[model samples]
Target: MSIGVSANRLELLQIARAVAAEKSIDETIVIEAIEEAIQKAARSRYGAENDIRAKIDPKTGELSLTRNMTVVEEVENESQELTLADAQKIDKTAEIGTVFSDELPPIEFGRVASQTAKQVITQKVREAERQRQFDEYKDRVGEIVNGIVKRVEYGNVIIDLGRAEGIIRRADGIPRENLQNNERVRAYIYDVREEVRGPQIFLSRAHPDFMAALFAQEVPEVYEGIIEIPSVARDPGSRAKIAVISNDGSIDPVGACVGMRGSRVQAVVSELAGEKIDIIPWSDDPATFIVNALQPAEVAKVVLDEEDQRIEVVVPDEQLSLAIGRRGQNVRLASQLTGWSIDILTEEEESERRQKEFAERTQLFIAALDVDEVIAQLLATEGFTDVEEIAYVDLGEIAVIEGFDEDTAEEIQARARDYLERLAAEQDAKRIELGVEDAVLEVEGVDLAMAVKFGENDVKTVDDLAGLVTDDLRGWFETKNGERVREPGILEEFNLSAEDAEMMIMRARVAAGWISEEDLPQPEVDETEAELDAEDAFDVSNMDLAELEAEAEALGLDLDEAAEAEKEAE
Candidate 1:
């Protein structure tokens, strides 16, 4: 108990306790601190050139320092190493690589070494205690915690959570929220990590769960099983989308979350410093679910492309801005939450959009034409704006309008029939470009399934069908559009009819020079214009009827002959 003391045991123990207390440490930590302190003292007092060690019993008030010497064949450094014989004198079984120690006389530490030891021991003990503190707090991730504002540094707020300190990064702090040192505030444990200095705790006041938790605290239904929060997507400090389902049929999820006069959600809003939250109903149907996700804006219709996972929403023009949100944030969040690509448009926008679409279609129709704009415009005026429509029109109907005879109408229809052929040839050309298998297009008025079958049949071009006679064409047309012969209907189901079909064939015949101009529509001459031109050039007033008829007959002009005087000489 009374080994002649250098520094007072009471003073050393008191300093160790103080270091441990500063970090809320345990007894073993204090004992380790005591051992480190004594080790420092012995090193400075007796030369560090000599091997020495110190130990303090954790339960008992005991301290000891002894000189330890390694056993060797011969003494190399007389100050540190002892010969094997001498080592065995201390410990009979001492061998090479084994250390033997002997009790040493108590010694005093010098002023400088003593002071240095104090600082070194205090630093080591503080570092040990800090590790212990970090270890204790590391397991608290994902939990709400109460901490006091400690200090602010470089846009980071340091908080003193009761057991450890945490950092609230600038981004995690609520904007414009005041923090006073020592003021208590609650935050969620956003992260827990370790650094060289100590454990790192991250606190956040702007996390989405922060809002949910705030709601749970304020709203009874949300806190209970009556209202369940199914999913949440958020942009901290701006807006968030939360989907809720209700278990109790009587409770409305939105109404319950909103509470009386918006009190429940308003409380959460206040806690989040006015971060807007949209609560939407969760649905098993994705389309319905997306509709809910896009809220406060009414959606007119939702078209979901299941294969692409895309949702095209048609909304009223006034609601487009709302549905898209400011800078498209609303739809972006909705897309993220619903796991679908969203395209939102107003009703008017959709209409204008369709018009542009049809216009493009009409242009494509015109480009496929073998005729002039007059015919294209005429066909469009009759609502045949696409090549498919023209190809399927009957030649009889075509002969009724545009004043084309059967032969010319058939010729026109034949050219219009080339659309599908061209399309198939294009696909085949692309296949050739890709160095894939050679492909061909097949056209039939078959239903979708049968059309696909026909496409596989290699009936690629209208030119291919030109060899087919009228009877074969009739058979194909009937199989495709399900139209009966000569039916009275407002509009034909087939893009082309049998009469139009004949016109297409005849038109092909004309272009091949197989038919004459007389076989086509001739330009009708205006009698009035011809007569006027004749009167301007010739003095027909003095000509006799016989002379006029003879001259008209010779000139290839149809003359209007009146009672005329005889032309005597000539």
Candidate 2:
């Protein structure tokens, strides 16, 4: 106590110190208590209209108060209105708006105001303490704490977490998990806040971090340096995919976390209300890695394209349905686990895909046998819309089209052998070149003329021979005119027992950068149809511009004039 302060001031100082030490109250509470006490003392004697105010030196226990008043035209109530005479006693030049306060009675006044002052002081101290608690706890978010369920009230469960009471709203509680009063529960402190009732703490049993916390408790390998959890994705209370990696070569991270008979994972899953847990081994190679992400479903093949961060999974025909899981859960979890987009397909679909693809390649190379509008347009590209056009169309004429050059046109034409002799020689060389047995001769019901023609065209491999248009192949054999030989005929011609051709084309397209492996779409029969149609639409086939130019020149037509005519035709 200060020398000027009475015994009452010393007692108030002791009380302020006790409240300040309560952890919930800071020095603000002490100052507020003293100020309130002094204000109560000033108001008691001077009347409430006096506009009494107070300030207390909390460290020294010194109290001071002023009776606030206005200098009016004439004083009405002496308690709140100061006259020019009263104001001039404190200040000689008291103006119309000036105020003055006289020091009130000291020692006796202090003793008389003690009780009312104490009540006001205690009330202010409580308010400051509540604010302090609200401020202190609000910063401790995302922490795990143990609490006893006090009671469920108004759709919220009040938890006594020892240090403070927290409210677990109904939304944060897992369904069917009954929490009774006095029962101990572990929850994540999701949010600590200030409510009208003071500090409002929010606890959660349904947060994803709750499941993570459970694993941290049950899996020692995860807590230790042996296993590192890279990411956790969950559909809380349903299923979750956790990607984990082994820090040490000797440690099997997935196996360690799974435990014997899945005891370790089962424990965490039980804590999360039977939520399914998928423990996947993390991978550096996204393709091989995605294969591991969608677990419990056998993946036949994984095709990955890194540029798009996509992965395509080919599952066995029987496992396709499971690989995608109920509502696509398997693939969904796989996507979450690898952070990559994924597509799932079956073996049979992939097979039919290859068959359709082989037929298209065959059609692309059979330029001479087919002279339809679209084929004519493509053929016109090489200045060879038909067989007759090819005999005279020169290299420069071929280069005039979009992507063709003299060398490319020659290569295309050389590859497009329509005669039986050329077909046979090419097939013989292809057979020796690929080191595959020549089985086309043994194809039952196949004519000797057709077989000879196939050999002449160097169609040794199923894919190479499959490279001819059905109409052109028909033209070569002269068995049937303009009849299309599609997949069935090509399969028969090559004696192919399996449809491995689709996978091959996909691999080729991927290698060629036409389609990324990760973003492989479901194989479609019309994959090449649009490109073929676009080629057909361009009127470059068989119409050798050079020959047209020569004929026009004979008629005295200029090169520029011919080009203008061609553009107008287009």
Candidate 3:
């Protein structure tokens, strides 16, 4: 007797096997789903109150329906439980908590029960299919997969990836690349996520790594680890740059990646829809790497600012356009590949900037130090960029300059100090006028000028400053104009380093009682301390005689004599 439709017990197993194979799921899971459907149908056929269960035999494809009743000392619900005496009639050894099964004939499902069973089986199969997809694709992320374009809805392509379906959002697709139904395409499996609806397999053609992976497949050296691709930047269907380094001393990474007569790179370019690929050698030095990244554009000079992770590249006036690319794409990609902000300048621009800086420094020295332009020009030519440098430099350094004596150096430093003091006083007056709170000024690097800027921006309190991140503070100081200018940031105007800004923010946090002393920045150890023997440096209080001797031996110092010398010096 069939429980649903016209199928028999053996046919149920046959259907489950076919579905499991088709869906790439386990046969046991399908069998359990069928059993649940059968149980639901059986309950509908009999009374709903009966404790019904359905089981299917694996080997023989046999189906069984039974009603389970528990044996207890006293039965309040007769349908579910039976007293010991009543159960003993069915089984002489029946005891408390023992379950008794009553076998029932196979069910003859009506049309409504058959429909309900179909729905149950369909729901279970869908859930199983979702689980199968999630399990199969979860580990396949970052792989390149080929699929047929199943359909497109609102510019989103749904790809049929053989065993699963993948989605490529419009933004993830290469620009100007149109996909038609049944068209075979390749994409990177960038993301695989499980959602309430189902497993989502996101594919991308514009990801930077997608191009890198394609090259890795096309180039044998890259695939075999002889050449490593450290970074990649792409503009999708336009241009792409990849930085490659060679492990073997003799192997040329760029030549190997380019293949015989550009075959390897052409393969990648074809895959990327005619996008231009520039294969450049990677360098440990960022300046050299950036120069290499801006190839075919002659670089006159490269000035690196390690503290800011920025590079100023000066190219010939004719090569400026080539260095910047169409709408700055070349420099932008170069910046991304080298992990630095790049500023492109022409030779003429650099020369003009130098002259302007020289004039400015000369004027500054003349005003601050009360010196003639000739003297100011001498100081500027010696690379005294600001008053603080002259004030803090070794006296010999300044006196060595032409026409400057030791007495002249002393007077210059004293004047620089006086000028700084007066500047600080003026800034303090302005800060007070702007109503900046004293607590903000208490932060180590939040001087009078910074405090005034903060007041202008409504960051008047210590808590306000503490709430800011380094980037927020940096952005706060950025000029409102779109034109890029040197020294545009307030931090730069005040000669404050990023570290200084971070320390100031941390100080504000500490002053607001938002953090403990343990969160404070550790004091940097002096170079002399770092040069000491490890035993003496790390554990001075617990040093043994043997360790002390070893330390003195390393330093070529006589322990007793050194102690006597130190005592006499003290």
Candidate 4:
């Protein structure tokens, strides 16, 4: 079947089938392309004013050309529309809005017509190819694919992945790995997206999941799910760590991943250009997992700050360099694999830090509770860092402390309570002196210290506090160079939960009258303040009751009419 000028039969179906097979697209798409090209050429050969149509038989490749006219009540255009009186000559029952078709003779393929048809077919085929490429590769994302390096441009490698070309940008390739034309590479398909040109397949050899996929290929146990590779952290071609756990107790996950004489791991290593891998056993306990992640180093102890998701690993002085790796790579990869921030310390450093914490806590107890060094040290050793714990702990707990009798425990508790009260009173006075409004202080959960901090920042009114978000309040105490910085949110001294901070803001809103008390849990009023209000006199010498009510309305206050009745009785 020839596709050329001066041929009796173009064999369009055969040509479409051949092109579809070469381009890896559907045959119907190619047939439509041919029909569109023929239609365009027919419009050019015939008058451009005529409505030309073209169709090709799918099986025989026979071409048909015709002219179509719309039947209208009045013929608006002589070339495209015909009145029903003229349409009835072609068909007796022809009505308005009906299309009339008139068969035309086969188009003679002249030089200009053939050129136009060729260009149209080429354009249609290119568009169909782009659509096909987009559809084919869009769902292949996140899979490991093998491709041949086709070209390199400005540190980017273009890979030919059989049906489509993929790009591995310089940042997505392993560091220091060089590629040549036709070099076979295995990379993870990180993204497949359609753009103006076509679908772009983005490949990455530096992705951490790429290393895990390679292991899954090398280890049958990982592939079969007997041993699970839960997490992987990679430094590209330099090093990586994988945490693996075994569902079956008999099979060792690390041993199975290592294979016989390290053959399986060695295969993956070769593929990754000798990237060293540490296969660590996964554990539910974060401390144990972190200890395992920092392998080849003798860790003496691991202290986990669970709130911060940080781990402090203390090792022998000799193992400090090993635990930190070359330029801290080991600790960095371990932190990534375990999803924790790691701090490596020598045993001597850990001991020194412990002693410093002990001294700080003892000094805090001594200063806050006015206790002697002996009692402060005892409380600090018992893990009481502040006076709050001593003030609020159960009496029995203090009594059970070694060398403490019931009377002595009571004395210590009373002293702690007194100190806290005095400190709070001092802070309250300072907050008032700094011009903090009573409405701001009335908001529940914001202590005197926090109120003083707010006053220092000029957030002195309930409206100001209500306008703030949780983050604004959380950043109140952060400091830089002895001045508040507002970058770090709520340091350990604040002791504010996210919920508590948000609730404080809501309380401020209620106090500011921006929202009603019915919108949230009402704050408890002090009993002493309520009694004092009951005893106070309501003197109306300065203004009448109506004027008082107007002033209260302006201040968003509710005046009790019953209290007015009591004042009248008096």
RMSD of each: 26.6, 21.1, 5.6, 11.9
Measured by lDDT, the strongest candidate is: 3
Which ranges of candidate 3 are over 4 A from the true structure? 1-7, 71-96, 406-411, 435-467, 472-492, 509-518, 524-570
Name the TM-score of candidate 4.
0.80
Q: Against the true structure, what is each candidate's TM-score?
A: 0.62, 0.52, 0.85, 0.80
Backbone clashes, candidate 1: 22
Judged by whole-model lDDT over C-alpha atoms, candidate 4 comes out at 0.85
lDDT tens per residue, model 1, 49-123: 877777765444566778887877888888778887887787788888787777876656567656766677668
Per-residue lDDT of 77-187 in model 3, one digit per residue for the tens?
Answer: 788889999888988998899899989887677777778888998889989999999999999988999999999999999999998999999999999998999999999
Better of 2 and 4 by TM-score: 4
Give the Å error, residue 284, model 1.
2.6
Question: Which tens-of-lDDT digit does each residue in 371-416 have in candidate 2?
Answer: 3445345564433424434534565665556656777667544544
Local accuracy of candidate 4 as per-residue lDDT tens digits, 1-570 = 223422544566678889999988889888888788778877887888999988877876777788999999977789999999988998999999999788888766667777778888888888888888788878877789999999999999999989889999999998999999999999999898888887888999999888888888999999899999889999889999999999999999999999999999999999988999999999999999999999988799988867557678899999999999997889988988998878889999988998999999999888987789998898888888778899999998888888999999999999999999999999999999999987777789877888888888888999989898877755443445633233545322685765678888888998888998788765689999877776664554466778778755764556775346447636
Which 10-residue window in model 3 sums to the lowest lDDT?
A: 476-485
lDDT of each: 0.69, 0.67, 0.86, 0.85
Reference-based lDDT, residue 414, model 3? 93
Worst 10 residues of 2 by lDDT: 475-484
